[model samples]
Target chain A: MKLNSIHSITSSELNAFFEENRQRTLCYLESRFPVLQEDDIEDIFQDSSITLFLKIQNNELLDLTSSLYTFFLSICINIARNKVNRSHPTYLLSDNITDSDFEPIRNDKLEELENLVGYEIAEEQTDQEYLNWIEQQVREGVRQMKPPCNQILWSFYWDGLSHRTIADMFGMKSEDVSKTQANRCKHKFSDFIKKVIASYER
Target chain B: MKDNSIYNEQIDRFLKGQMSTEEEQQFKTEIGQNPELKQQVREHLYLIRGIKQVKSQEEQKIILQEQHEQKVTPLRRNWIKITSIAASITFIMVLSGIEGSRLYYRHEIRQYAYNASVGVMSDFAASSRGTIDEETKVHLTDLFTNAQEGKDLAETIDELSRLYVLTKDEFVDIEDDCAYQIGWFLAVSYINDGDYEKALEIINNIESEYPDNEDIKSIQKQLVEFLK
Candidate 1:
């Protein structure tokens, strides 16, 4: 049987289609961005899915010519780039490396055509929807925790706030944030996973 | 110092770049030498990264679509009443009930596709083994080659049923991948035999096993009416 293009799918059809492809999308995202933790990957996936769903609902798919996978890849890449930018001002001092030297995929000055094409194909295959779904689930799980847990998580990760700072913010003993966050989130996260697995098992 | 509250606080402080120089140095040392703490830091950092990239372009479209739906057919106008009524009846009678059943069955047909996927993987492994097993190869090739060549679909379908049973038994101990590989073959064979029901049964089983096989679902949906 031939697989049809995503364009022919109605909004409802697209929802079903995205749900089915979620796993493949997550696998592809994880493979592409090994730097991301599993939880982080899942949050990104949720965001992407919400975006895709909204886009379909609004009839905002402007360019019918672009493949769904390609459009999603561009979105995921941009999202990743945005995250990197938000996290830190600079990865490191440029030092000897000049601006022209960091040309992304082209940075490998001696790259062959086959390698380039292979990279493109790999990018094309990455499923942004699945990644977004997983990311959303993790975020939701985190949100259910206490404020201290939430603050510990966000401060440690997003804000890069020190444990002492988090403690000061909460008026708690500074060193307690890490232990508190981990202890609180782990069981809740496990229960969340159990729920997901149960849904799939059915 | 006795409480270790200062050190406990360092976990978040060092990770977020908010610790004092001495505290930061201590945290880095801990990170370098302590595996569990390092892993925790990595996971937390990853979560933050993921949360930051949640937005996508699809959202913009859905918002626009909502606006269009509201504006295109303004309320209190009753302008397209006749068309709307007819469409509504058609949708309820046909699309809602009957089509819903078709969708249910379509889900079932996906199983065949999953089985077919698994069969394909085994075939690959068998072929890649590089041993010259002519008789086995010929038999396997014939199974596919003759699966859909019959004039009478009923007879073909019966044969497909037997083939599915045999294939199912063979793959009992194997992974779902084998089912995926051989599901298409079974599906096609049943379609040829005029046993769309049996074909659909296999498809349904695979669909339950592998919900993501959209290509199989589409094909199964197309065949539902044809076979019936």
Candidate 2:
């Protein structure tokens, strides 16, 4: 395939180009999003190809300085990002947190953490076991957390939503407020885990 | 915590390729200095990659559907016209005491089976899985490509049948979609080769195993009618 503008390429050539890249693109997507269903992956590939074709037809590729595949990749990434954003809302603040609300961990909570780990301190546990314990504790704690706080952490950590987007979706006064609240919730969750460990040592 | 968020935001920008060259260099320096920040950046990158995969798959589906429609519609319309004309010609030939109408119908049926086989092969290629290694993947891809190109279909059918037999015991390890696809392709290949008995046998087996698989059931029905 000669490297040139999209305008010079025939439809058949365009289709051929897509056909050649189709399997490669699918493999790339599969490796990245192994969690996605096969049907969903196929859907994204088809959608991206069509978008690329349309862009080429409309002379949109003329402005693209990178190779055609790179442009196609960007389209795929943008679409995936948007889909994730829509499906997973990050800032569903059922409980809001503030810096002023901070409190020291209770003695009992630390004891609970120690008991859960089956050790005097977290360092006694294997790295994998320690991480798993923390994950389980965090999950349990988040469930009991106020709505927005759990939602904020879930969105930021799991869904990977940006603070600005979280703020807009959750009706926060500003991105700063969302960020601070998220930070507070994170600290609170960590504090719960620490308290549990601390009580074990005491 | 505030500084962490700032670092996270910078990591996000870096991953998204929104950062300038100088900013990206600075971000790299920060990551090198802070192990936690580097880990956070890696996690964010992984998440974004997954999202991209999902998005790309969706786009592929749209493109394939449009291509299928574009390819099938004209052929279907042309088939209708050709069939109508063939039917009229057959009527005239019958009236003229020509004994060739039977042969014509058989040829038409064979063509239909061939087209159906091609369709089944396409579906199989689209959903085929179960390759445990790169060599197996390459082999399967070659077989499918050859089959799709209408090259040595009998060999392709044998390869597919062998694969089915090899993987039959590991059904739990293989996805149902992939298993069904293999059976569908094998049955279709039999139909195309005019092995109605073999086709019916495979179809019946698939139907028994996957009663809810509409594609297999539909193929079984078509094979039954064709055999009749």
Candidate 3:
């Protein structure tokens, strides 16, 4: 059986792919940004993997001209570069991180997947689309939370920006301040969701 | 607030696999024993998942928007917004009818996937690890190519099935995915030969042996999307 470019990817296959590239990807990131902690590097890689998984899940990726690992590696590097640039504004990134990097692969498969998720949820529960409903509340909570809390939580939670990067993005004094603020904002966001859920339940 | 913070941190640790085995065991036991703690943990999980889901949707939108440079329409989820408890019950009844039709619909799925078996050929070509000689490899290629084209499909499929049985029984302990990839090809051949049930059985067996293998799962998902 002759396989062409990887058109279909499974979650486990992707995990294997990520693990296969882990050591070399780590070396590449570390050589570029020595300040990155192992945890940070791990987080970046995991997030990139999740991004790739989401793309595959959403049917936003497939029909690769090159190897699957090559496409995956590009995603990892793109994510890392964005993180480093945000986390260290003083450090100059390249001039030509082009806007035309990758075109999101799209088709009707996304809608099909959405309907599949919806169907699965409906199969599991009947009272409400509570999962999606609560997710909506989370989105609202981001908006309704106090000025900086909304912005802070949006960056930290919705954007998956690191606390230090949040600090840098928001012009906060330090990461500690950012963490504390995020904690407060997260609580408020939780409260906002809890309150709405309580009413809906009633 | 500090208590909530401490509680949330513990949940975060557990979710991120940052907890030690002993600590994780203790946490699980506590959740088992304590209702309030369990609820809190569940709430934390839900909140984090909810936030991430929102993030995922937003990122998808951004990507799609960039691709089309046009406004992506809202998710067609009003059907999912299946309002009212009475309507939900009705929907469930309707769903039960769907469940009944599922098997009937599945044959069509099998037919579509059978036609899509050429994908397995790509899986074979991309692989580099095999002890098979050049002559046998050429023979297999000709067989697959003949099957792929419109020429002598049944005869081609029969020859492939013979090779499949010979290969499957012969390569019991072959290391790595080569054997399984061959199984995948044969399963596709079975489908092509109008033995959808046999193809599914073979697929299920492969899944049982290598539960986490995505190649098999990808095929499964592709087939199921017909139902979806």
For every model shown, what is its TM-score relative to the native structure?
0.23, 0.30, 0.37
Q: Chain A in model 2: its TM-score?
A: 0.38
Tens digit of lDDT per residue, candidate 1, span A5-66? Answer: 33343344455545644664565556445566787667676667666655544445532223
- Model 2 chain A: weakest 10-residue lDDT segment is A96-105
List model 3 lDDT by residue over A83-142, tens digit each: 887888788776554222222211222222222223222233332234334434554554
- Candidate with top TM-score is 3
DockQ per candidate, 2 decimals: 0.04, 0.02, 0.08
Question: How many Å off is the CA of B78 in candidate 2?
Answer: 22
CA shift of B193, model 2, Å: 2.5
Against the native chain B, what TM-score does each candidate's chain B reach?
0.36, 0.45, 0.41
Order of the predicted models by TM-score, top scorer first: 3, 2, 1
The DockQ value obtained for model 2 is: 0.02
Q: Which stretches of candidate 2 lie above 4 Å from their native place? A: A1-202, B1-62, B65-132, B145-154, B170-172, B209-215
Model 1 misses residue B51 by how many Å?
A: 3.8
What ranges in model 3 sit over 4 Å off? A1-126, A129-135, A143-147, A158-161, B70-228
Most DockQ-accurate candidate: 3
Mind giving the per-residue lDDT tens digits that candidate 2 earns over A54-155? 664443432333334556755765665555456555624223212111222222322222222222123243332233233334334555767577555544
Q: Least lDDT summed over 10 consecutive residues: which range in candidate 3 chain A?
A: A1-10
Query: Which residue runs does candidate 1 get wrong by more than 4 Å?
Result: A1-132, A143-145, B1-46, B54-228
